[model samples]
Target: MSTSLLIMGIGGQELIVIVVILLLLFGGKKIPELMRGLGKGVKEFKDGQKEDSPTEKKTEVEDNK
Candidate 1:
C-alpha cells in the first residue's frame, strides 16, 4: 500500500492549485468575497465545536471530583 497526503501544502503547490480552482470557479473579482465568507463559516464552526465537545464537560466533571 502507498500513502499519499492530499492537502499537505508542504511546497506551496496545494495553495496554488486551490487558488487556480477558486479563480476558475468564482472569477478573480469574486474570490476574495468567497474566501471571506469561507473564513467566517470556518470560524463559526470552530467556535461551535469548542462549545459542544465532550472534553469540556469531562474537564468540568474532573474538576468537581
Candidate 2:
C-alpha cells in the first residue's frame, strides 16, 4: 500500500526532474558505470538468496530428523 502511494506520488515531471538532477550530479560518462555496478550488486544479492534457500531447507530437514 505504501509502495503504491510512493509510486503514485511521483508524477512524470517529478521523475524528469529527478533524472535531470542525477545526470547533472553524475555526468553522462559516470552513469553507465554506476548502473553496471548496481546491476552486478543486485545480481549477486539474488544469487546469494538462491544459494541460501537450499541450505535453509537442508537445515530444517536435519532438525526434524
Candidate 3:
C-alpha cells in the first residue's frame, strides 16, 4: 500500500466520504483547480528530492575535502 494510505488509515468508505465532502465544499468547477495545484506541489517536492539526493551530497562533500 502507498505511504499516505498507511498513514491515514482511510478505507474505501472513508475515501468516498471525503470526496463527497470536497465536492460539496468546493463544487465541481473548483475541484479541478485544487487538483492541479496539488499535482504541481507534488511535482515540485519530487524535483527537490532529486536535487538533494544523498549520493550527490556525498560526492560534493568529497570534492570539497
Query: RMSDs, each prediction?
Result: 5.8, 4.4, 2.9
lDDT of each: 0.81, 0.89, 0.94
**Candidate 3: tens digits of C-alpha lDDT, residues 1-65:** 56798688987788889999999999999999999999999999999998899998999999999
* Angstrom error at residue 12, model 2: 0.7
By descending lDDT, how would the candidates be arranged? 3, 2, 1
**What TM-score, over all chains together, does every model reach?**
0.53, 0.71, 0.70
lDDT of 2 by residue, 1-65 (tens): 35774777976677789889999999999999999999999999998998789888899899999
Number of clashing pairs per prediction, in order: 0, 0, 0
- Per-residue lDDT value at 43 in model 1: 100
The Cα error of candidate 2 at residue 41, in Å, is 0.3
Off-target runs (Cα >4 Å) in candidate 2 are: 1-8, 54-56, 59-65
Deviating ranges (above 4 Å) for candidate 3 = 1-7, 60-65
Q: For model 3, state the Cα shift of residue 29 in Å.
A: 0.6
- Candidate 1 per-residue lDDT, tens place, 1-65, comes to 11344444244576678778888988988988978999999999999999889999899989999
Kindly report which residue stretches of model 1 are placed more than 4 angstroms away from their true locations once superposed. Answer: 1-18, 58-65
When sorted by TM-score, best at the front, the candidate numbers are 2, 3, 1
Q: What lDDT score goes with residue 29 in model 1?
A: 88
